[model samples]
Target: MDDKSATFVVEGEGCEEDVLKWYYHGRSGRPNKNSGELSSKVKKYLSIKGWVFRYALKNGKKELQYQSPHGEVYNSLRMACKSYIDQGLGEGRMGNVDPKQPKKRKCLSIENQPLLKSVQSESPERRNKLKKQENRVVKTSKRVREGPVSSRNPRTVLSLLIDNNVVPMLGNVYYRNKTGPPLMKGRITRDGIQCHCCSKVFTLTAFEDHAGSTNHRPAANIILDDGTGRSLSDCQRQVSDSMKSTTTTLRTRSVVEIPKTVKAANSIRDENDGVCSACCGGGDLICCDYCPSSFHMKCIGLKEVPDGDWFCPYCCCGICGIGYVRDRSFRSCHQCELKFHGDCLNSKKPSEMKTEKNTLLLCSQNCERIFYGLQKLTGKPILVGNNLTWTLLTPDHRAHGGHGMKSSAKKENQCKLRAALEVMHECFEPSESVETGRDLIEDVIFGQVSKLKRLNFRGFYTVILEENGDLVSVATLRVYDNKVAEMPLVATRFKHRRRGMCRVLVDELEKNLVKLGVEKLVLPAVSTTLETWTNNFGFSCIPDDERSKLVQYSLLEFQGTITCQKLLK
Candidate 1:
């Protein structure tokens, strides 16, 4: 080629062979290839290394030309192939090449001169940005070279232990003192301080004074390095001895006598009057069921009269001393409804009981078993379903055994109840009235009736059906005083409805109500089902004017527009 059109070339004739060898080595274990395949492979390899190959005229001869994006051209494939391989090997792309034939060190070549000059011709703004980036890299490297600095102040107890090089045991007690080693070892206790060495209990001040006394000796030998030749344990002991002597001198000078005014104030506070026990005077007082003393509701923190008789803390026998007034934590005896602390049931602390307010806390376990036995005698299954069983549950059952079901079983039952209620209200009740009825079931039937006494409302009796231990249906019956009762929530699973399940539940409930001397049954029926209820159950809708007649029976507060009553002769 003429000098004017000649392109740079590597000083080798087997340039194509060298490129093929490198390509095959990189993609080893691939199928063998012919001349055409070698040409195609080399083109692909060069393209990946950011070099493009094209057939172009050089000095009137058509030859393959290779060019980089940075504007360097080569007519000889050998030089272009060498440049691509060098860049790949330097960037770690050519893996595990023969180390014996080490790669030549990269140097600024004549072909790279154009790229360097182009970079140097950049605008001042761009150059300044590049310089700023280089400075940031240097700052970052310096930061990495320097190690982290720690704070002098210890923020937590764990940090303090770490700083002192003290390995703490689970039950080890750490003490802070003004003198000596600053921290002395002791034992943790429920009531007060206990000395680790002597195993004696003492108040906080007494323990501090005793621990720093000259007679005090190390409870256990601890190896410590305090940067001194002296034994750390011996040095610590000497410091305590010096502090004890100094403390004795200070204590003698600070001693003072009790003032007469302070003594007189204490005496007046301790003196008791022979009137109402809590406030020394009575306005409206509630007499304790077990004690002669009476306490004003306000004095004892009682907002309202208890549903059952009240017992003074002194008279109440239990681990929880005289139960606080208005404290719902106090459980009641299932049989008597008399308040007692849960701990009193088994002489266990509140934490150990693991029983809820609804859990039956009987006077004794025997009473609990008897209550269950009574339920077995009186209660019966009312609704049956496919692979399902139903049983009646009363508040008395909950008071004795906590929900009359296991936690998992209770959750399953609640889910079934919620599902059944949702379906029944949607199907039977008006759209607007559905929410009201649901609220009644949620707030009254399921929520409060079983746990709290509202007005003359007695308690809730639930008939729940289970299929293979999963709840499927539930019907809630609310009993009221004056021989009256109301059925608020009666529902069966959608799959089990119209199968006489609800009918069986109501029939069994009616039989039980008769046994309990219930003379009348009040049912809140939807407008759509009023006629069916009236015809099938012999219920007659009470006129709006007659709603006042139900005030005494508490039926006047019913939310449904149609209040039906069935007289049970």
Candidate 2:
């Protein structure tokens, strides 16, 4: 056989070496020895036809693999090259095939020579049309390889299907046999679907997936659309028009009789006299004695009608008379404006009254306690009777008769007095001067107690004895020649603070000083508590010049001290 006949026979058997030799010799008119050069040329031609050649290792041997864009891979390079040449020739891409090229006469006949020549000599317009046809074929092949193109948004598609009353299948519906029932019936949703035959609800994905098992069509899909010549667009337009008409009608309608409705309400209210002022006309109402207002007896917790008179809280005048009145006869609190009936006061409750002689009435226990507490904190008189007294003792006086005591009782009293005095000194004295003044006061008290039968220094003192015979507080009232009295010491036991003990002591001392013709009271002031004396007790701070003017009146020469004084008046 000739070279062309040998090539044709080798090509039929699909040999890579013979195919490469045929392709190279057909194009260059010379047999190519380099397999690499021949393979490169073949690859270039295949690429132009949208075929790709990839090199890979298979079973320890280097192999050339070919794939189409549609992902069809050829197992052999010879087969891929033969397929590519056959496709190119069938599409007239190799129409210019040389007539001199040798081929098997049976395959390349004279009848096919004219057709090939005509294709090679085709016009530009015909070639352009052919190119367009090839492009369309490529695109169609791509579409076939991929699935259908879904251009619409999923949500929009789903809504459209729902509005059209069409239940689109979510996925493929499977079956055990052609007539068998499906295992899974439907999809789950917030609101499930209802069955028509049994009048029950059933949610589903596809009718075919569940119809055989349930044997019932979905209620929503019972009405079949037999194409009455109406499309989904027509139904959508109808729904939109109805919605527009509803919104327009709502916008055009006017509010009805708003003013007349309000007027009717007011007239009904006037007919009822706007209800009771206190009870809103909910229960039995009584008119106020001093005003047009009325209140319910049940609302105020009143049991019976007042025998004398009745006044509402608004009608009462001033703080003394103002408060809810349950009875005909009531008394106002001396400390506050609240008034309560005489029967409301309980003897068991704490009273503001300092002594049994005090007759002031208080409305409640809280107000009474607060009143007494304020009096105690401010050092005012807390008692009214003459139960407490002031006595003066001299260093030379003897402990005998009514005032005399046994040595043991006297020693105990001295110790108690010393303890009380030390507590007072610590509270009133500055940190630096506490020890200095403490020793002096101790020496005076101890020296007198040790040397004499009775405290005999000619100094005035006031001591408050509790009901239990314990000293609650004490003070030294020093009377001067200039009609001024100085309170050198005033101290209460720590446990007795805020109990009016100090207040009683101060009151008794002042009364005695007034009897002695003392016109003013002077006392050393602490920087921290100076405001208590000035604001609560009406004492005023004396300036340096004014302090000197009163120096001759003060018996105790206070050095470098801030002093406050109060007039006896």
Candidate 3:
């Protein structure tokens, strides 16, 4: 790195506005990792500093207002953040504090350079081909050094937190009434948690109130999602536990994990499994970083141990196509079985991708399509029949709870889920469910359905029907590869059958199924209803020889049942 370096190359003497632009926009380094991700970064930084961004109507137009740690307000987000950054740097200067550096970068560094100097410098400092990194690092020390972040240093914590992923929901959002996390119910924005239960986004500086209001039960069964899956006593506890312990858990960058890995390496040995999953042999095998599965280098076609961390086929991040991550918690889509790291997520909103549509690409657009698409369909009602109505009930419905109408919303879902389960029980015996261990079908409806994998029950939705607001028909559906869908169970209450309620449910399902790229719908029809399915629904009986085409699916079948299929496309 020299004085003639390109990063600080100023072609022309930039005016005061340029200085301010660089001050707010320059680091493009710390907060605001990418062009559109600025709001996310700034939101997190301001949040940690007790500043909240709010909407205000000015001149009949909505504008964001930045409220300070105290009651003071700033109309400009950049200016307020700048003042705070300068204040942090000033405090660091007064105490002679040295912020922690995790690694030594070969690129040039910012040192002895203050923010004020960048703004105030008007000399002939201009150079050609100015190289400005988005997130440029400011050197507090003349030389790069690696050390632990000081717990007493607040600014050090700020930088560390800024570099890591600052997602709205720290943990997976859960609905107690729903079996799994809902796709559309609880939304996470960059700045606030869009709670599904209360249907409100609490983004004020007094975010403490959010935790407080949710702590107590609003209704007998309606428990508001506090954004956190677990219950803390109050909002203050939520803050201290979430952000205060920032020193230890989220302390350093990826470089800091090296020592921990090296220390663990000392005790590394062949896993207790003793045999390679790939070879069924043990000698000279490398273990997966994320799981007990081990493989011979040649078995997986790896030349040797070539990386910082080696994730097996199942443990890798889907986006970055890499193994190591700053944040250890890896997320996976139960549908696609691909893994993801929080840090690797582009976190691009739908609108952001619209403007940069040609440039930005995601790992799998279909997964996103299904995610957002299903999210949109969760509570939407589809009028499919002359006198009946159809609606898709995802875990999202359980999340919304009818906008805080006490336990009624939750109780209604429970009743519907129970009703659907009853309709299935009426048609399928315990034997029909493929050995329920002598337990009643309804008893195990809500239990973990993993064992029913052959049916692909993991990713599914309940499409139900109503005749004048009363539950009349139900079906459990799952789509795979968007090429095939299976409705394992469907039934209309004996009395509701004359009203074409089941027809409405199937019609609504097929409409959405076609939209999701599904071509065929498969289902198991019991002996008694085989004619009804084959003759009325235009479903052809699947011959035993051709049934193997659906082998990839775990289609639920009764002991005495005929497999049937209907082509949608």
Q: Which candidate comes out best when scored by lDDT?
A: 3
- Give the per-residue lDDT of model 1 (tens digit) for 1-569: 44343344322122223463555444454455564555555566556546666566666887777887556878665566666666663254454344223222211111100011123654554332221111110000000001111112212222222233442222345344335563555653322345667777543334556666442322222222233323223333343345457756764553344355544522312322112332223233455554344444454565555655566543453445455653546665543234565545555322112346534445544344444443563334443444445566553324334535543334323433443344334223211211111134433334343111211123455666544333345666655533467775565544444667666567756776676566788876655567868987688976655543443233313222456788886
Cα RMSD (angstroms) for every candidate in the order listed = 33.2, 54.4, 30.5
**Residues forming the 10-long window of minimal summed lDDT in candidate 1:** 137-146
Q: Please state the error at residue 209 of candidate 1 in Å.
A: 69
Candidate 3 residue-wise lDDT, 1-569, digit = tens = 12121111112221122223334464454543353544444455456546666666776666667776676777775667566555652234223222222111111122222111131232223211111122222221112111122212211111222223332333223223334443223443323334556766433211234433332232121223554443211322333345436634543542365465543532223322222333233344455565544444554566545444556654566566676545667665544445567666555221112221232223355655655566567655666655356777643222322122233333334444555665554444333221122223333343224322321234566777864344567787766545567786676554444666677678778888788767889986655567988888889987755664444243444333467899996
C-alpha lDDT of all candidate models, in order: 0.44, 0.39, 0.46
Tell me, by TM-score, which candidate is best. Answer: 3
Ranking by TM-score: 3, 1, 2
What's the TM for model 2?
0.27
- What's the true lDDT of residue 477 in model 3? 72
Candidates sorted on lDDT, descending: 3, 1, 2
* Candidate 2 clash pair list: 186-204, 186-205, 193-202, 194-201, 195-200, 319-337, 394-456, 395-456
Question: Which candidate, 1 or 2, has the higher TM-score?
Answer: 1
Q: Compared with the true structure, what per-residue lDDT tens digits does model 2 show for residues 344-456?
A: 55442525443333456544554554344323322112343443333332111222212334433343233334434444443333221111111334333332221110111
